[model samples]
Target: MSISTSAAPDTGRGPAEHDVRTQIIEAATAHFSHYGYDKTTVSDLAKAIGFSKAYIYKFFSSKQAIGEVICANCLGQIERDVLDALEGVQAPPERLRLLFTVIVASSLRLFFQDRRLYEIAVAAATDDWPSVQAYKHRIHQLVEEIIQAGRAAGVFESGTPLGNTSRAVYQVLVPYLNPVTLPHVSALHAEAPEALYQLVLRSLAPPA
Candidate 1:
């Protein structure tokens, strides 16, 4: 007598596994959009995805963990837009200009197109989300690259350390980039981006 055996569950990132994960993320995005992150729960996510809560647990540890992934995905898209915009810019100043413009435009578009995406971004800024810092660091890295390019080209002065300078640049734009403040800013002035961008450029200028 032989015992019947079944294949183990697909746990890897094979096509089938990837498809299921994508489905979950999509459903989670919709739920978070309609209900807001604070109101969304693991059970709601699983139900919306047509999977058991235990099934979601098998992949993600908690509801917050899933939200963090969604935030990271949005940041990844923003990074791609920044890189794409920078490609045609020949000068560092121009690269910096495009970087700020593209990001602001992209953020506004994302917020207006689906305010839920912006809400998740706001959580990243206001709450101490674990994965949020990584995305912020990635953004700062892009800014530093442009600064370094400018220094090499003799277009700008770099008296301070590049790392410190980059941090200052990103921090100063908190109002414009921080999802928490971004909407308010936009609400007051729809065309405030160019004005804010001027301030960004001034920050990078060498002291006289």
Candidate 2:
């Protein structure tokens, strides 16, 4: 959940400067929520926040920069939720199932309940924003971790290299995870997670 302070305004380090940066982000998020990311502009944000466009520029280089922070925050919440759901679950099989279920549910909730914010997510994915790339890498790592644990427990076959297996599994989850792809597959949304999880489990099963 740690956002890179590198994105912070060049203003000197202090509580006051920090507050100003936060104010800009908060204001931008609210504006984007109301008007949608594509329709909003830095000038519009400055007007809303009562700061000049130049002042706002000191904090963020572009509209996408501000969106990146908001997108990171949203994706961070999903990662936290996934971690919380996995907490205290010792069984890799169950953990894998929960991972699929929780992520899909969380994503669907965001798409349905917060369409405006979801617009930002869609932009992030389409534009190949750094935050979205980092999120995908983390999710891939989580899958690899679960696969490694499964191998240790002898519940999953070790014949396939771990990297290949994990990547294959992650690819299967991409349609559900990628904001841009999720809507296209909406018809399968309800049943795909469980069906995919079973298919993955079978693939990972030890040979007879």
Q: Where's the lowest-lDDT run of ten residues in candidate 1? A: 1-10
Candidate 2 lDDT over residue span 23-127, tens digit each = 877887788878999999999999998999988777677888888877877787788889999999999999999999889988887665678878999999998
Write down the TM-score of every candidate.
Answer: 0.81, 0.90
Candidate 1 C-alpha lDDT tens digits along 1-208: 0111111122212233355666766788889889988888989998888899988876666776666667766766666777898887789888877777788877777656777666777777788475567767678888888889888887767888998888877775556666778777766444565666577677767878
Best by lDDT: 2
RMSD, candidate 2, Å: 3.3
lDDT for model 1 comes to 0.70
Regions of model 2 farther than 4 Å from truth: 1-17
The candidate maximizing TM-score is: 2
